[model samples]
Target: MSINRQIVLASRPQGEPSADNFRLVESPLAPPEQLADGQVLVRHHFLSLDPYMRGRMSEGKSYAQPQPLNEVMIGGTVGEVIASRHPQYAVGDKVVGMGGWQEYAVVNAAQPGLLRKVDTTHIPLSAYLGAVGMPGVTAWYGLMKICEPRAGGTISVSAASGAVGSAVGQLAKSRGCRVVGFAGGPDKCRYVVEELGFDACIDYRQHATLDSLQAALREAAPQGIDGHFENVGGMVLDAVLLQMNAFGRIAVCGMIAGYNGEPIPLRHPQMILTSRLRVEGFIVSEHMEVWPEALKELGTLVATGRLKYRESVAQGLASAPEAFIGLLKGRNFGKQLVKLI
Candidate 1:
């Protein structure tokens, strides 16, 4: 139990992530055998694997700094505090914070926004890293704030069965927007429509071409898309652009189609001008002030069963790298998590 095992960034990915990009190692936990002031030791129960981590894996600048070579891969975790030198954090308190890709984290209390307590009595702990956490906040800000979808109006989002996308569609529907989703396959499409209760879902794997995607979008959203949450860029964005209603809003949450280093070109710039559309790219951390309000709503929705989600769980720390690669490949159906304990 004293060995802290972690997955570290070994190299930058050339195209898609592979085994060469990550390496796992173990180090003795608390080698000095003493707790330092302002340090809290947390034993990770679950770690979240998000698309944003992909951006951090690459060398270029984006919203976050790249994952430093030989360092533990960065991720969010829900853990129980085992030792606390900080008065603010008590032993046995459950907290959600950046524990990285390790089983135990000795986190400093001063990192401002990095650590916070969460109540798991009404919600599952893993969910704090998903539906009611960063991804959910991302869905809320990008949809309610940016999209502003109205009742009876059609709204669409890509990767609609994934973490942020699923929440986006559900939130839109709760507001009475006719919701349509773009998922990768027939199974995910079924889950989006039947389980998540979206009005319609497009199996984008079947509609691989831009023309086909336009056809599918037109058929599913016959009223014309009033708002869009853009998780996928490239062909999907271009196709959705053509079907947008005049003055429609697009919240660019993520462009996962190109996250693996491929260049995903957006083809229809003319539509942005012609439709007088509003498009904005957002990072959830940039809008942290809205988290409390957003989490309250999301938590209530989940507790009441009005909001639902699925998960792809990898059972151990050793499985993190492969599971992450699966996530980038759209092999994961919903939120991807690693069980570290």
Candidate 2:
């Protein structure tokens, strides 16, 4: 008897997505008889708005395919099960999965890589969509596996106050590596260093050029960067490459700086060969097997006051468009979420 409100793609975005690209429509809820055996009906509570979703708005193929036109925009969400024909999940159980930008969905329990029941007793259900979710796992596996920083070494991270970036800096610090972070403004830089416990943080907005960034980094870590967690590509990455020590490792998590179709030329290819640096680009979904272990470790760290997280939450689904626009514009302080009833 319930009807669902959903956000569907009205048109493919040429560059950054605007409110006009999304069309909110109403659809009749799936009938109980249509529910497959071991399927459940879920009402969405929290929706994740990520930078990667911007790539999905375009038609080009990358790590994941673009969302088809008129289809619901795909995203990770936390929801409450309203009706369950499945033995594993009961009514009122909270779960996290790819629920898209919709109010309700019928999910098949037997579907491979579907929803996972969350234990909300220890952490808030929203954490599953942020810290303990894909972003956390992305930070953990990318840094530990790709850029293995040794004790007494130095690691540098861009967008260091962001969800994944913040996690990377803290994890490196915990491992005894000196951490340096790069954020947009003075406030975020201060938060990264003072609140997030980073060894040092540079305000990229204040720096006029790559030379200034280099000078700042040199002062922060006299030994030079042994490992780099790259979230923003372009001149910043080029500058970092110039300061890397021999045999440095780079984990390429994202290219937020050039996400809006900016022209960013590769200026320092010689660093990879001359410095013997290993630069690897990774998609977090490829390392799904390690998620449980990462979650356990990160959960313990957060619960024990070792790991810290911050979220910038939008009040409702109607605010999702603005929140997403802000996220792309670097307006969000941390992980951005849309809280929907």
TM-scores of the candidates in the order shown: 0.97, 0.97
Report the Cα lDDT for candidate 2: 0.89
Best by lDDT: 1
User: What is the Cα-based lDDT of residue 201 in candidate 1?
Assistant: 94
Runs in model 2 with CA error above 4 Å?
A: 31-34
Taking the tens digit of each residue's C-alpha lDDT, what string does model 2 give over 224-309? Answer: 89999998887778878988999999999999877777777778889889999999999999888999899998888876778888
Residue 24, candidate 2: Cα error in Å is: 1.1
Scanning candidate 2 in windows of ten residues, the lowest lDDT window is 257-266
Model 1, stretches more than 4 Å misplaced? Answer: 31-33
Per-residue lDDT of 208 in model 1 = 64
Worst lDDT run of 10 residues, candidate 1, spans: 30-39
Estimate, for each residue in 74-105, the C-alpha lDDT of model 1 and write its tens digit: 99999998988888998899999998999999
Candidate 1, residue 305: Cα displacement in angstroms equals: 1.7
